[model samples]
Target: YLASEPGGRHVRLRKKGKTASLTFKVGRGAHREEREVKLSPKQFAALWPGTAGRRLRKLRYEIPWRNLMIEIDVYRGKHSGLVVAEVEFPDLATCREFKPPRWFGREVTSQNRYSNVRLANE
Candidate 1:
C-alpha cells in the first residue's frame, strides 16, 4: 500500500510472504532518502486498512554487476508485461559515469511516467 504525506513524502507498506515493512521516503530518483521500519503480521494487518493508494506487486531479481547491483523488476497484476531494470550508484558522479549493458534497453530514470507511483495508477 502507498500514501502521500505532506511535503511530497511517500509512505509505503509492503509485505513479502511473511516479512513486511513500513517505509517513508523523500525526494526522488537517485536522490531519495528512505527509512524503513520492520513490521510484524499483526502490525501490518492493523495498518493495512488505513493505507490509501494504488497497490503494486512485482518480483525483483538482484544480479551482481561490475561493482554494482542490477535490480530487475518484473511487474505483476495490472502492470504485467512491464519489465524494468535499475542500478544504484554511490554518488551522482558514479551514476553519470556508468554505462548500461546492451540488454538493458531504454533508460527511463528521468521519466516521471515510469515512476512506481505513476505506474501503480496505470
Candidate 2:
C-alpha cells in the first residue's frame, strides 16, 4: 500500500457509492483488528487525491450460506474480472471445519499476492 507502515498496520479510506469511511487496521493475517469511521463527502474529497496510486474499486455482495455469510467481491479497474469469496469465522476450529462448495477453486488463504494491499499497489 502507498501509505502503509512497515508492519501490517495501515489506514485506508473507502468510498462506497455516496458513502465514505476511514478504516484503521492492526496486526496481520487472520487475526487482525479493525475499526471504521464514517467520513463526510467533503472529507473524502480532500483525502482522496492523496491516495492516487493506492486505490481499488470493487462491488461486494454478501450471500447467506447455512450459518455463515460469504462475502463475494467483484473487483474493478486494474483488477477487472477478478472475483473472490470469503467466509469469516470466529475461531480457528470453526474455520477448519467449514466446507466450501464445489464451485470454489484453489485456496489462497496465506498468499501475499491476493491481498487487497498488494492488489491496490501501483
Candidate 3:
C-alpha cells in the first residue's frame, strides 16, 4: 500500500530510558510505539550520514480493518515522494495487493531508504 499527501502534522508523546519510544494518534490508530536501539553515533553515521540522497519519513494512519493500523512512509532525497505502507498480518501472505491511491508514487519495498534507523540520521 502507498499514499502521498500535501502534508500532515502529528504530536509525539515520548518517554525515555532503555528502549525509548514515542506515542502518536492517541486514542485513534495503533499507538505509535517506537523503541530506540543501542547504536553508537559513529555506527549510526556510517549507516546514514544525511548525504546518501535518501531520507525516511513515516505516517501512522488509522484503518478500519481488523485490529489494524497502517504505517505509511514517504522517502526523501533521491527517493523523494516514494510511498509504502506496512500492515501487520497474522500470516505472511495474509495481505492482499492493490493499486495505490492516485496521490501515491511507486512502491519501493526492496529499497534500502525505507528503514527508519537510517532515516533518523539522514
lDDT of 1 by residue, 1-122 (tens): 46774354888888887999999889877677779999999999999876544778899999999999999999998889999999988888989889999999898987887888777656
- Which sections of candidate 1 miss by over 4 Å? 5-8
What TM-score, over all chains together, does every model reach?
A: 0.86, 0.85, 0.36
Q: Write the per-residue lDDT of candidate 3 for residues 1-122, one digit (tens) a residue.
A: 01111222222322223232232221212223323345454544454433233334444454545455555655555456656676644533444443345654555544545534334334
Q: Which candidate would rank higher by lDDT, 2 or 3?
A: 2
Clashes of 1: 0
Query: lDDT score of model 1?
Result: 0.84
Off by over 4 Å in 3: 1-59, 65-68, 73-84, 96-104
* Candidate numbers, best TM-score first, in rank order: 1, 2, 3
Location of the lowest summed lDDT over 10 successive residues in candidate 1: 1-10
Question: Which regions in candidate 2 have their CA more than 4 angstroms from the true location?
Answer: none
Backbone N/Cα/C clashes per model: 0, 0, 0
